[model samples]
Target chain A: MPSPAGTPDADPVRASAGAPAADRAGGPAGEPLIEVRDLTRVYRRPRTSLTRPGEAVHALKGVSLTVHRGERFGIVGESGSGKSTLLRLLCALDRPTSGSVTFAGREVAGLPERSLRFLRRSLQIVFQDPMSSLDPRMRVRDLVAEPLVALGEPVGDRVAELLDAVGLPASAAERYPHQFSGGQRQRIAIARALAPRPEVLVADEPVSALDVSVRGQILNLLADLADELGLTLVFVSHDLAVVRHLCETVAVVHDGLIVETGPVDDVWEAPGHPYTRALLAAVPTLEGML
Target chain B: MLTVDGLGVRAGDLELVREVSFGIGPGERVGLIGESGSGKSLTALALMGLLPDGVTASGTARLGGRDLVGVPERRLKDLRGRTVSMVFQEPMTALNPLMRVGAQVAEVMTLHGVAAGRARERAAELLGRVRLPDPERIARSYPHQLSGGQRQRVMLAIALANEPDLLICDEPTTALDVTVQKQMLELIAEVAPALLFITHDLAVVASLCERVLVMYGGRVVESGPLREVFKHPRHRYTEGLLAASRLPPRGTRLATIPGSVPAAGRFPGGCVFRDRCAHATETCETAPELTAPELTAPDLTGPEPRGDGHAFACWHPRR
Candidate 1:
């Protein structure tokens, strides 16, 4: 078997340093970047009795959606709503039990690791907790350069460039993740995610862990990055108001199903479904109350 | 029914909380809002006399006219769960795993000298009051058996079992889902009296609190009637927080506070927020006093009652 670090030549479409911005911007609608068709994922719980098999958990029940190229799409749901499962399926980290997930017209649901070079290069994810997502032992430089290194790409001044893009000083490269505050650590995470120059940036509850004062900073950073890079963003959050702030279109998932899908403003203004209405009502907005 | 004056919490030489002063009137709800490391939780812990090992509290925290600072653990314990009770953020860990939910509620009353039989009966009643579905069945269930919302309701049941004069809740609904949080907030509002609700969510505070206290770097930077302070914040930190909380137009950048919060005990001397504030001047190197903002009208009377004045500590506050 080959070493853990794959050969750079294996993937021909390596993102060049200082790629031009707006290369993928201004794409017309109806150009689907990610298309799902009746996607479903099921898991079996651990067995408790000797006579019976483990009970099956239908995590995603016939979910379907489309993400347009260069579009900002948001998936909003509470815990146990299968939003995480859907994200994993989209990233090809997990295979669907049934149905299909396609990326730019190519099937990715059951693609093996070796066959996922394009998917891996085109998509990157930023997780919720910066503390757990970043490696504590590694310096900020190595952490940011990790994806590049793993792809067997050359280690140039890309680390510094990424740190700068994420609004961190060059001095941060030498520090460990613990040396930074929560917001700064999240910036480090964003820098690492962008190091690969992925066209699709999948952020899972990015600002949920940061303080309210710093939340806006991170959100602004993400919005600015997405716009400047012209990257298609798939943001998953539990708060609809937060999703509305960053995403143009939204899909509200509940009980492993898409309960509502529309422009964020339409859904916010007049929710059609009962669950959607209930969710909007329950959001505890500062609108008139403040 | 609770008055905290110059409350400070120290871990050895490091001052984690400094000169935090506030009050909660009889049956009035007040919120202590701050991000992590801002010493909001530390203030609650100090008031409860539950500071961690090697940490000591200074200054006076009077509950029902009895000073809680420097009090014996036994006396504090006596005061706890009767005169002043606390409900923590995570209900799952705060409760005992082995005990039934009802028994845990009953134990608080039994510990405070209630008869076992009466306590058991009252626990069921308290569970019902918290609006937990199937109160008897819920009482028999263990903490692990309940959902996050139900578990929080159970914690509320236990906290309210003794009908304490003051209830201190530290991010009580933060762990639940939005819908569940709404119900929990309603339940808390219906039950808790003289509440000191602590949370980082501005929306949650606005929904529940009549008064607000904004803490930053271990100090109460701003406090006032919720609407007035939120509408016209005097402190830069408070202004930034309210701006950040609102969802601006899509595609536009949010009005963000420039820097992250400094770690505890590492805040700059003098003004704790000067390093992050945009209006900081040379004079900001000296700490600004937490005084009521000057009013334009000369005929204005003296300071409002214990819990009702708009006060902030900022060298150059928003006009």
Candidate 2:
């Protein structure tokens, strides 16, 4: 998959797909594009009487991270490990009870409602459930073009071009989602997320729902998109193999805590924490670890 | 021993499951592996006689030397949780939203004739046994109050309430994160019940189960020991699943199966995997009879071929 609205320098980035990814865009140790500090979200348990609930559920336990610009970073964890909470908080769909977020040196945590919309454009999100995320009634092209319409941007005629960037034919614009397969729908979702030309793309379990037969292709597509677009990718998945195959740097979470953070190769080779080691050991392999 | 002989499930004109059969020795842990709609879960449901209305099943299922296929509804109901219990895929949906977690668990024992107040104590003990923190505090909470992992522990507590001889786990750890999933597997291994652990995740099956039953298109494609089957899967479908999985033996790019499991009911009379099988030939036009191809391997068998406990139904065995 190629990046949309390509500039003259796109060919070089695309050519580097066969080369080492870490050196593709030079070193990533510059100023961080996304900085999260002590972010936490809590939910109260349901109760019948006026009696207050006990200690609140700690969906997020002080998660803080610095994501460098153009770095393909990954957050790996199992269910209820605060990965989803961190994603939601970053997307601004849910408010953090405590903590701050600085996006491009701008404090996103305190961004007003009107400014949040503008911020949303620079930070795009692709959710786990593509079936539910895309409207069944709407055709592919219309769904891809929704962001453009929402922002009242003048990309009216560029919709077809966006669809092709995600490896879909221009003709797919007219067909409804029911006509396409699971992997096809995810391709459309990726196209929609790319329609705005966002700098950072956060895909939450993007390939988790697809069949195993088609998962590798989707992973390759996402990786290709990240490389070509020079996009800072934050891939959230419980799958260690997929994360290992994609991301350069990784963060491991357990029970709402950031257990460990390191290079993907280092952690995979010799996990520092016992939880990470167990997590590594837990990955079902025909042989062993990646 | 549980023996399923020529079990088939038909709904309307569609055959959801076709002539599925397997045997689980006492204290056996058999992992059933397959992709979605391949009839793995449906097979489990059919075993429990929990198929939807209009679905008809044929053949006989004998559980511990007793017939389960034609057993009356009353007898099956009595046997379901008492003699044979199951842990479903989703813990949240399996639990009742309106009831307290403890009461829901206790309800299982109570239904099987445990006293009213006694069940709660039993429930708390099971919860503690599963390593839940602060069992008393958690017992008072509702299903919605607990986390996904905690709720899963509750489901296990409920299923094991009676200490049934046979415990059927249908993708029990699919909803759990990796660490919790390992812990859950360790718990199941410790219990060492006659387990039928159904899952698509091959790694969990490989590490946890001693034997495996690989399913495809609502049929048992391959059955054998875990490590042995992994190294040499006789059927092409089994090879495809193993290849598709990224875990295990790195350097192997997941061999895409090219197509999904065919829809049930109207499958071709030819070999079930013929459409996707690379070795498909005219002989596959007729469904191959279940054979002992795996039994003939020099390294596969010990002293005698028939005694090693593995069987595969395929015309063309992998080299």
Best by DockQ: 1
lDDT of the candidates, in the order given: 0.86, 0.78
What DockQ results do all the predictions give, each relative to the true complex? 0.39, 0.26
Relative to the true interface, what fraction of contacts does candidate 1 keep?
A: 0.85
Q: Residue-wise lDDT of candidate 1 within B215-294, one digit each (tens)?
A: 99999999988888899899999988888889887978788888778777789988999998889989999999898544
Q: Which parts of model 2 are misplaced by more than 4 Å?
A: A1-32, A37-64, A94-107, A116-118, A154-175, A178-181, A254-257, A282-284, A288-290, B114-125, B133-140, B247-255, B262-269, B277-285, B296-309, B313-316
Cα deviation at B133, candidate 2, in Å, is 4.6
In candidate 2, chain A reaches a TM of: 0.87
lDDT of 1 by residue, A50-88 (tens): 999999998887778788888898999888878999999
**Docking quality category of candidate 2 according to DockQ thresholds:** acceptable
What is residue A153's positional error in candidate 1, in angstroms? 1.4
lDDT of 2 by residue, B264-304 (tens): 65456768888888898999998887676355346654442
Count clashing residue pairs per candidate: 0, 10
- Name the runs in model 1 displaced over 4 angstroms: A1-30, B292-305
Give me the displacement of residue B233 in model 2, in angstroms: 1.7
